[model samples]
Target: MTEYGYFLSCEEFTPAELVDQARRAQQAGFTRLAISDHFHPWNDAQGNSAFVWSVIGALSQAVDLPVTTLVTCPTMRLHPAVTAQAAATSSVLLEGRFALGVGTGEALNEHVHGDRWPSFEERGEMLEEAIGVMRELFTGQQTSHRGRHYTVDNARLYTAPEAPVPILVSGFGPKAAELAGRVGDGFVTMTPDADMVAAFRDGGGAGKKVVGGVKVCWSSNREKAVDVVHQLWPSELLPGELAQVLPTPAHFEQAGKLVTRDMVADAVTCGDEVEGHVDTVRAYARAGFDEVYVGQIGPDQEVFFDAYRELVLPALRR
Candidate 1:
């Protein structure tokens, strides 16, 4: 049987509401929880981007489900040394039930400090070195790194995990997956592409766990849900260079005129029907994911969870 779970998109909920949602998810039979780490929401319609680490702290006390960052990048907004400590403390707070899912972040999240957003090459370099810094701190060693992207001076992680907190690297490209396989404890990607899994393993990430996440929109009023996600998340469709020139949600919304509800529905599951969503997730399990997480991007978390707990999870668990 597949172990079904929930993924809380932090962009959609307030800090306290997020904690409550996780707790409710636990009560509803979710075995694990993955929270998204975003510094900013692509649109105001998306509404709310709380610091994920703080949300994790509350979830630790409020729920029993294991937690992982769907992804956080220590390479940019945060120094790896500090991220190491944060990860360690989070593990402690969760009583050793936390994993750190990391990635080379997008400019939308990392460019907030008015810092020069390095090219992908520089970001990869930073990620490569940052993992080393995290590994050193995880070992409970007093360490320093003089790398091209990072310089740490006599750093130590006081709160190390009782058990190792696995580092799962999120990859969108071959080089990133290769790096994850080389440096990470596990590999994470959104697509259920086994060739990508094999690539990660081939890159020397032997025996690393593979995890995937997918989103579904479930509601009796499917059109409402579709409109919400489309209105808020049309940024998903912005083409290559166009996304760069578009600065805000309003820009994206204006550009979103090019996108229709069908486009959103084509990419995302749209409807209250539960079995189809189950099939959607089972596809990941069939693709060889050790674990798969499903997210509802519709409005009304309470109704979504009720229907999911009563309707969807049973089908997936079987």
Candidate 2:
């Protein structure tokens, strides 16, 4: 059976709101929670970016649902050692109900330190090394590493989880999928692409959990929902490496001006039709996802959760 999860958008809500959403998600029958980690909102229109680690700490106190970072970039913005400590603390706080999802990271968050952004190939190499370093530190022993991108001197995590934290790798293409297969405890992506899933399996990911996420806007007014997605998440529609390469929220907003409401309507499930939302989620399951996380794009979260609890989730489970 495919477990259904709820996505907590850190970019769009305050920390308190995110914790409240997690509680509501559990009440609404979501089996797990995936929270995004972003230093900045994709665009100013979305308008919020709380530190994800702090929010996760709050979540530990507020809810019992298992939580995963929808994706975090430990290679930059913060060192892998620091990320290891945060993940370890989170796992301890959650009583072993935490997973780490990592990726190559985007320039929007990474360029903040005034460092030159490396190419995708270089970024991938850095991510692989960072994962290795973090995993070593999670064993709760003194560790030292001298790698191509980072250095660690006598780092040890005192509060590491009793068991190793499961690490999921996010991928969007064949090369990334192969990397995820080779190193990840699980694989994560935003699309329902069977071929990508197959690539992961073929590259040694068989039996590993495959996780996917989708965004939907549920409103009585379809046009208004489309408008909300257009305003808040136009970055979703960017093609190729644009999302990774964009240096700032201002650039994203400038690029997003080209994304139309029609595009969002076509790509996102909008309005009050429960069947459409159900089918959208089912596609991920059919593509062999072990878990599918659905995020409501705007502020109508209560309506979205109520509808899912009362109508959509039951249909999907059947």
User: TM-score per candidate, in order?
Assistant: 0.93, 0.99
Please give the clash total of every predicted structure, in order: 0, 0
Give candidate 2's error at residue 127 in angstroms. 0.5
Off by over 4 Å in 2: none
Q: How accurate locally, in lDDT, is each candidate?
A: 0.81, 0.94
Q: For residues 83-161, could you state the per-residue lDDT of candidate 1 as single tens digits?
A: 9999999999999899899988866677777787676777778888998889888887789889887899998777788
* Residue range with the least summed lDDT across 10 consecutive positions in model 2: 259-268
lDDT of 1 at 208: 77
- lDDT tens per residue, model 2, 264-314: 888889999988999999999999999999999999999999999999999
